[model samples]
Target: MAQESKPVAQVDVRNIGGIDEASVTLPEGVSILTGRNATNRTSFLQALMAGLGSRQSSLKGDAEKGEVTLVLDDETYTRTLQRRGDSVSFDGDPYLDDPELADLFAFLLENNEARQAVARGDDLREIIMRPIDIDSIEAEIRECKREREELESEIEKLDSLERDLSDLETDRREKVESLEAAREELESVNDELDELDTGIEESQTRKQELENAFQRVRDARSKLDNIEFDLETERSTLSELKAEREELHETIENAEKPDENADRLAGRIDELRGRKRSLDDDINELGSVINFNEDLIDGSGIEIYEGTPSDDPTDALNADGQTVCWTCGSEVGTDQIEATLDRLRELRSDKLDERSEIRAKIQELTDQQSSIREAEREIERAQERLTAVETEIESTESRIADLEDQIESKQEEIEELEQDAESIDVEGYDESIKLHREANEIELRIERFKDEIEEIDDEIDKREAAIERREELKSEREELASRLTELRTRVDRIEETAVEEFNEHMETVLEILEYENLDRIWIERRETEVREGRRKVTRTRFELHIVRSSSDGTAYEDTVDHLSESEREVTGLVFALAGYLVHDVYETVPFVLLDSLEAIDSDRIARVVDYFRTHADYLVTALLPEDANALPEEYAYTESID
Candidate 1:
């Protein structure tokens, strides 16, 4: 698509940061960048276009020597544009190598010239009159949207790692308490056993003393019986002597009454007296035993009485001592009686002492016997107690055994518990395990969250990129659409002017000094777009008439090729005059560039300059020194390039 009449005018070069470079201002309106011809003016021209990188010709310049900038009507795009060994680059964009943007860039340099130059043949001229996209802003927005999608996905993974650590710590604490409780129970059982052992030792010592006391009592009882038997025999001898004294006294009285033999009577009397004495002594020998039976019974409070004995009393305690009837009146001797009495007294005393001694012994032994019996009873009880204690000890041992078995079983259970508790790692290991588990869970959640966010972000990035790209496409569409409208307007104008008829009229109007007519002077456009390709507006050029040189009558489409040198220059000047009719200017700057125009007559150049001054404010030309006088005074500004 073609921009109306705004042609690129001038460029200003500035050393912006001002680091050792010179700056200069180029003029608008047909400035000739002039110096000596070989003094770098052409290279300066190359430098001018180098500021717009693709504006350089097929031959571009060196980049490393300097940086450049171009000022356009909208904004300035600056770059270090240059060529490096057959490659063109602008701000590191490979200008010559890129076909799309580069082609559009190259079009600016060529299209700025006249369209007749394109019809006459210029390489990049045909493309620059068209636009690719209306604006470049849409391309930048797509780049930003894609970058945002990648950043959000990384944050989600960190959250899941924190949760798993909490659960593992709780299980480890319970097992330690159970082991402590078992230890306390065992301490209690050991204390109970200690107390029971002390009681059993004390009971055994007391039982031994009881057994010794029972044996001592039995020995004392046997000794008291033997001593009592000796005293009883001695008292019985004294009692028989008292009975003989009574018989002797009775015989002595009966013999005195019989008077038969006096000598025999004397002898019998002596015998009877002696016998009586003996009997008396014998009777007295029993001493107080016979008589003391009553006294002893009365004085000692015994149960025996004085009476004739019938055999011996069976229950006598003092049977070794005898009883006598001392109060029975009978003849007896005094000396013998005294002796018997003395002996009897001795026996009675012995019997009494023996009875008292034996009785005392018996009483003492009886107490001892009772103590012995009690001791025996105690021993029996102790035996029973010892038996019971042994049974208790056995039972306690059995209980201890059972406890041990239980402990063993509990130990096995503890082992099993320990095995199960392996899952509950104590000693701070549980905390680590729990933390790892929490971390793993958090990691999984974070990964899933990241995946979800990434999917959404990627989709959004792609959609935004597509939208931005569509906006660019829409800008191109708008450019193409506007071009279609402009092309349609141009077609309508041409058709309304009756292009075929206009061509005929234009031929007549241009009949002076011209050699050959253009092959295609009238333009036709096809405004329809191709759906899939560059649907740029198109124009067709046509020439319904030909021009000829008046001298040779030779014909050519481009007057520059076939006409005489002056004819060619006059025709080009005529074309420049016709362009003044077509172009509009608020402050008119009518300009042209003509190569090899030295063949034109000075009179014709004067006419062209006068024609320009009538309609324009500024007219500038590039020429050799001889061409300066061809313009009227002040009608044109003249600049010469060698």
Candidate 2:
């Protein structure tokens, strides 16, 4: 039974197809439009499709423009079709942002590619996979990979920084303890100096002079040590820079030259791109022609057009019962048209394959070009680095020479100061001299400890800052990991889900329909290598295999050609349903429009509708009176549209 509380989706049509003006409200669940062939049922459906963002609708023959307005979810969406010379242009916001998915899956009409592909023995896999843009997905995956790599690198650096935190803290603690101990020793030495007796003032003066000389000698020696350390550090750096320069020279010499064929590859890629554009134009034209013809043959009467001549009307069918070709007004059999459409379809498929091959060739050539560019850049970088390293070596050597001269001058000053301290006349003031030397040494120790502690504090601050950044880097890396996983599995997930849905639904439908001796009708997704241009590439193919039980109860394989029209139609619908589910179209559009189920018997049609109804919020189907009667009376039914 239809849910009374379910929200209604309202549609208003004006000058669309044969519908001049009409408004329809579709409730949730099944809504059957029970009418004869030309009661504007398909036109209403087309109008509804236009409102849903499908470009498959047409303007009325008598009107230059048409519009369809859809009101659902308390929101209004409008689509306008304007006739321009020979072609129609569409404008206005519609229900969907991109209608490709809805057109291929949600809008199930008589001439729909999904439905017709099976009838015409077309590539079912291609039709099902058409809505997916593989190139975009692959490009996104590549981008995700790059981001993940960068995140990983940053995280690694953070991890290394975190490992050094403990050592930094320990070093800071040791420096602080040493600073405290040195301050205590200096305090003790100052107390002892204050406790020294004031007797022998002259001796104290001589001791002070000797103390000054000793202090000068200590300062000179400390300066000399620092200069010598600087000289040694500069000498080490110079050696390293010289080694690096030699390595850079060797790398530059051994670097391979960039490929000379890059220009040729670029030209070839450009040519292929041009060919692809041409193929796109050709494919689009053929698709338009096929759709127009299919529309004409399926329902839209030629007499609906204002300029077309229809004197006898019956003359539209020749003596041989052939349709008058709309393009040339020549008598052409429907079979011939179908055959022509098949050829065009095959040609389009071939062009697509050719385009794929060309794309692969372009990618290959582009990769080669990238390699060549990288090689050239590497050699240039090596040469530049070599020159910089040579300059650094010269600078370092000069610095080392300056430091050595400073060290020699400081050492000579230290020796002269030490000799002066030793020559001091401190025979009676030896004790005073000893006290002064001890205090001076303690002060120097305190200064050295303070400097070391400051350096450790700076290092500790840096390490703590780096540790704080580690958490943020970890969070970013986790996000990148999730994105990478999603990107890597998107295509495979869709493929698997599509196959699973199709097989599961097919099994259930076959059971419900109770086809005699039919064991199974399942689609197997397989990959096989096929020659595309000069190269062989792996491509996915959907193999529809049928198993039937013979009279002896032994099951055997059967081909698609052996299937009846009703079976093919049902199979195609199931395939379309699989795509609809796989793409999650229900989230995008609420309505699933079904039309032209004339081939299936009424009972089977009812079962099929019943099967499909549960999958959608609203299942609007067009059916003949008899077929409509087979459905449950609980479904919403409309006999005529005004």
Candidate 3:
């Protein structure tokens, strides 16, 4: 809520200070009272202060009776000061009677005094930050800070919980990986067992086939033996042939194989080398183009281009007129030159990389070619041995064929005898039986690993739920922090704006009054401690300082004590006016009653009066005729007091 302006309509005074009786008509703005010493100017202003609820006014000269009557915008109120015995009694309107107004009046009276208390090194904060209810604001701020501290502590605890949750998550991840590996291994084992079962079945079938072939060989042997001496002679030759055939088989198995791609690798090397040469040429061309552009930009080849050198190379090129190309000496546009330079730089970088890569590939192919040549030589020796072995095997097989023909003719005679014989005992069936047993064991182990993985999965889900609860706590703490920030910001803004508004008006008034040696005035909020009985209480308040510049180009700050007597009076008045403005005193009492401002010079007094005319609706100042004449012509209301 804003304070509305209530200008005083009139005032009647009797037996107040030096005033015996006086009735004054106050205009809307800037009313001057001209009087000599002891003409009751001070008394009249005092009465005005008292009528506005100042407690400082008293009955004059022990006359025992004084009263001030004030006519405000809506009502007439009178305050009478009466002395009975040793005490004084004040009677006035109860609604208008406010102790706060008395404090404001006291500040103004102190401000206008010739020996200003602020100028005498009193605490300036106590004067300027008045009517702010600092005690109440400080209490609320303290409570807010306490609550904020508690929230911060809780947040720290939650952060610890979050760290624990993170550790649990890490453990869960490791367990999950372990479980996944176990499951994968179980699946691998299962597949291996399945393959083993198939291998066993195939082995059993092959065992039966070997038994059949062995039985035929035995029958043939029996038939050959039947042909006595002839079979014996033929068998000796067959033995020799079979021994040679065995040697050939061993030789063929040990022979080395040749690399079929030896020729292909050599051709790739050649192709890469040719590409590398081409890339080198491209790179060289790009380098020349880049260097030519650099020379043009650097002004090293301007004479070759038939253009004069300028401080800035880009400025030397003209887009409209005929311009010679720096490298080709052909007429070209400026845009074309810039585009060519940019393209050449890009091409140079690309070609350089391509050339390096091609060279590396060429080196790799050369190494491969050397390895292939060594392999080819080894293969040539192995092929010669293999060919000799094949020739020996063919000769041995020819002798064996002759012997086999005779044996087959005899075996036909013996086949009828062997058809009645039982099948010979089969061998190599033990390995298949052993593999079947192992597969059964592996299948059992796979089932156990799967069960363990399921148990680990359950533990991971529980840890994830705990992490969700931690997140909820973190979100609650964040809300508390936001609210705390808002509270602190509001408190600071209120205090800052109050001091800032006061300083702004104070500096403006000081400038208008032409206060010398003072450039700026402001209030600084500070924290201080005072002793209350045996306890120390900390308080926050404002302090005043004035900035002044010396003749030697140095700036310094000092309190109001550094000001002269008249300067201090002006400072005090300006400060008082600033407080009045900050607190919106004009709404309650729209009059600034000032008197005995003779210490201030006439020019400054005129300016101060002019300022009051705009800020206050009723400006009543007590001045001598000389000081009154200094006021502007617009302030025409003046009353002479006798």
Best by lDDT: 2
Tens digit of per-residue lDDT, candidate 3, span 2-53 = 2355454678888776567788777577777774443556567667877877
- Put down candidate 2 lDDT per residue, 369-484, tens digits, no spaces: 65676677778888888888888888888898888888878878867776777677655456655766676666666666676677777877877787788788778878877887
Ranking by TM-score: 2, 3, 1
C-alpha lDDT values of all predictions:
0.36, 0.78, 0.60
Give a tens-digit lDDT track for model 1, residues 1-642. 122443453433322111123333433333332222222223333334445443332221112334555554554645463446534334622213222232222222212223223224321112222222312222223223333333222222222222322332232233334434444544554455345434443455443443233233322322322222222332333233333334434433333232234344445545545554444334322431333232222221122234442333322223533332233433334345556646665564454334333333333333334344544554456455545545554554555455455545554554454344344323333333333333333333444344444555554455445544544544554555555555445534533333333343345434432324333233222334322122332433332223433445554444235545454344334333333233232222222333223455655554544443343322333333455454544332324221
RMSD of 1: 80.8
- TM per candidate comes to 0.28, 0.77, 0.44
Candidate 3 ranges beyond 4 A from true positions: 1-8, 99-102, 105-107, 110-115, 134-495, 528-538, 557-559, 636-638
Greater lDDT among 1 and 3 belongs to: 3
Considering lDDT, which of the candidate structures 2 and 3 is the better prediction for this target? 2
Candidate 2 wrong stretches, greater than 4 Å = 1-6, 61-63, 119-202, 230-288, 298-302, 305-405, 415-486, 530-539, 640-642
**Lowest summed lDDT window (length 10), candidate 3:** 106-115
Ranking by lDDT: 2, 3, 1
